[model samples]
Target: MRNQLLAVLDIVLSARLVNANVIRIAEEAHKAADPHLALALVSARGTTTNPVEIALDLEMLDAAVDCAKEALAEIEKIKRVVSKNVVELEAAPSLPGGDAAMRRDAIQENLDEIDEGFQICGARLQEMETVRDIADKRRKALVARV
Candidate 1:
């Protein structure tokens, strides 16, 4: 699940970043070019497709950010549950080579795995946020230009 979320997030972030950059360049072109040329560039040879593409990118970025946040929250919850179990396991006495000892080891292993997962999700969320911020800023700048 963690791997899947990370993969999805990576794809979304990459696409959003690229699209945002393209929109920014187009906006810049519009600002710097003459009236007729600006219109041609922004409308893509009079097709008026830039607005629709930008709108779609904005919508997808918003949805992806929301999904990443939810995934991070779910990871946090899992980490908390696993941490509590590990603590409880530690509080109990374990006989050498006994079942309790085995259980404790297993729980410890699970806790470690959860910790790794949390770290991965946290990093991915941070990266996604950075991309989202850049895209948003570019969008706002373009809007202001208009």
Candidate 2:
């Protein structure tokens, strides 16, 4: 019975870890999606005719996009683990200490957090992609002019 309880605890901890990671990634993605970044890109395009300056600006935008892509990949991996953890949590036997309800509640809370993290990350990624597209267009125009 102790072993069963420990197993459930382990699963809960694992799920919590994944949820934390998701939240961290979402936060990073939010930074990448900052309006200031988009505004800077636009300002660079409108105010700078120098190819070198434009190139540098585009590079910064590209880096943000790359960071967002990496975060997205990490989120996908975390999602798979979260799914497995949810299954394990559901199948966990009742704890010996009569804390099964507590465990269930924790699992549900973690799941909710993970879901919210995914939504936030998704929106941020979309915003980052839109910024990247604008940078791409500017870069192409610069290339054509040179």
Candidate 3:
């Protein structure tokens, strides 16, 4: 239970970091583009797109990857704990008949729960990887243009 709470806190902190990075990226976008040129483009045409925005968006993607890394760390920690618990339970000697059965049941329940959590975390990590791949492609395109 305490570990779950800590994981939640870690996720929240990571999310906050992502948000801050997004704001920084937006600020950078403005700095990278010439305001006069942007204004002229806006005036002449209905819409103006800055290449800098794509570069900044790539930075934002990196930030998101960082956040996902943090979450992955927490998930790894949880997995380690689960492994340790399983080892301890396995090493422990079985008590009298009924007591042994109860202990086994409890251990199995805990292991099941941990396994479920692990699967969820693993899926999310995979999703983050996909996003990172897309970000890499975007970065390459932006770099080629610049």
Best by lDDT: 2
What 10-residue stretch in candidate 3 is worst by lDDT?
A: 39-48
Provide the clashing-pair count of each candidate structure.
Answer: 0, 0, 0
Candidate 1 lands at a TM-score of 0.56
Error of 3 at 13 (Å): 27
TM-score of each: 0.56, 0.76, 0.48
Residues 1-146, model 3: lDDT tens digits: 45544543443344344434434443443343334233333323323244455445545545555555555465456546555554554555544355434544554555465456546545654654565455455546556776
Estimate every model's Cα lDDT from 0 to 1: 0.50, 0.71, 0.48
Model 2 alpha-carbon miss at residue 21, Å: 2.5
User: Could you list the CA RMSD of all candidates, in the order they appear?
Assistant: 15.9, 2.9, 12.7
Model 2 worst lDDT run, 10 consecutive residues? 35-44
> On a 0 to 100 scale, what is the lDDT of residue 109 in model 1?
64
Better of 1 and 3 by TM-score: 1
Q: Using TM-score, rank the candidates from best to worst.
A: 2, 1, 3
Candidate 2 Cα errors over 4 Å, as ranges:
30-40, 96-98, 142-146
Candidate 1 lDDT by residue in tens digits, 78-146: 556655555655555553456445555665665566566557555655655555455555556556777
